[model samples]
Target: MTEPKNLALRENKVPEPTASFWTIKVLATTVGETAADLISSRLHLGTQLTTVVMVALFLVVFVVQFRSRRYVPGLYWLTVVLISVVGTLITDNLTDGLGVPLAVSTGVFAVALMATFAIWYATERTLSIHDIVTRRRETFYWLAVLFTFALGTAAGDLLAEQLNLGYLASAGIFAAAIVIVAVAHFVFRLGAIAAFWIAYVLTRPLGASFGDLLAQPTSDGGAGLGTIVTSVVFLAAILTLVIYLTIARSRRAVPAKDRQTGIEEPAGV
Candidate 1:
């Protein structure tokens, strides 16, 4: 139902979302939570100041991302990483700074995300990332990304705080949910849009829970690895992987044929 201009595919385009895309997404979200904690708790900036600095960084990274014509792993992943931090901070501000309950924030963000999807679908007619060639679609994509992070933070906190599932258990639950979505998509012919959104939403909580598991104190039921250590370790790994993928993709780039025959694997791998 999308207009012809909106539906038109970009020649030589990279596939929109892929397995590697999700993998990197999960990693980025985890890094976001840990990194923000490192800067705030370890460095003693406090959440408010940290949020301001992180949002600025995210904007700078996004400018670079918007300027790129083709998918560049480093730039794209950088934007994701920064956005994750900013998103987490946004939720934290609402909950901790403004005294909004986690449940309320979660519900609010869920409604906002749904509204974003509705408007995006009504305007673009398709949510498929397979053919993202326009600025409008890209804008909607990032807005959704921001909301997903905020929603994930609230949901993760709700489970851990209200339900007392603990970080490890919460992470396990989210991971299992993601697996179920994957199975439903691959085995049961689930709609791609539904599967993608479900999985996308699940990754936020999964990453958040895992981040807490690594960074929380042993008294708090974590390994006590410390946020600084966890953030540094994950950021290094992500940077190395992004660099490798960038080099590899550049070396072996190929032309796109059609969705039927020329489907390339996702951007990460």
Candidate 2:
């Protein structure tokens, strides 16, 4: 791997394999789907308008995130949530507004994600999230994140809507896929970085499915929680976790070695 820019920046990322990390990630993704749905369907923003507004919001938050000197859990997770919403809106516009087929959207996003990864790896010679110290790597990381959400949105809709798998069924399938990745990492010797990205991509769909399951009505095979209610619940969960992390950081209680997340100490970090 090439030399990193700042060791301190290295600590800002790379830890994502913990229970709390996964919990917050899942909550953020769930809110992403339901919140976007809320704005488009409930508020009647229309796909184009919603996309514009959400993209603008994401850029604002992302600018703040990019300018940060180190990891601020609130800023980081808030950026993730906004990007998730924007990503969902992008896919929704392509499939629902533009009359594009789900299969086609899925294929296109899959190709796009692969291309991003290919270029990222080719340029950096390392795909480890731990190495994201330079501006270039950070750009690649955010780009990869955007593609993951968009691709997952397309693929999830392909399975749940196009394939008629139902929300629960689709969520179950992706959740099971995540479990398999976990097993492969711990039991079957899968590379940690590979497993992390695979599970990360899978979680976008999995969390979205669960969001639909809770937000949709019984006729649509969901729990009838309503999109507004689901969004509030998930957003609440994310906020609580972020607060805890912030307090932990302030207390100097969050020891790097004790993070328990997927972060490993790489050389020169």
Q: How far is candidate 1 from the true structure (C-alpha RMSD, Å)?
A: 5.9
Q: Candidate 1: count the clashes.
A: 0
Q: Which tens-of-lDDT digit does each residue in 77-172 have in candidate 2? A: 999999999989999999888999989988888888889889999988878877666677778899999989998999898899999999999999
Give the top-scoring candidate (TM-score): 2
RMSD of every candidate to native, in Å, equals: 5.9, 5.8
lDDT values of the candidates?
0.84, 0.87
* Candidate 2 to truth, TM: 0.90
C-alpha lDDT of residue 228 in model 2: 94
Clashes of 2: 1
Q: Distance from true position, residue 61, model 1, in Å? A: 1.3
TM-score of 1: 0.88
Winning model by lDDT: 2
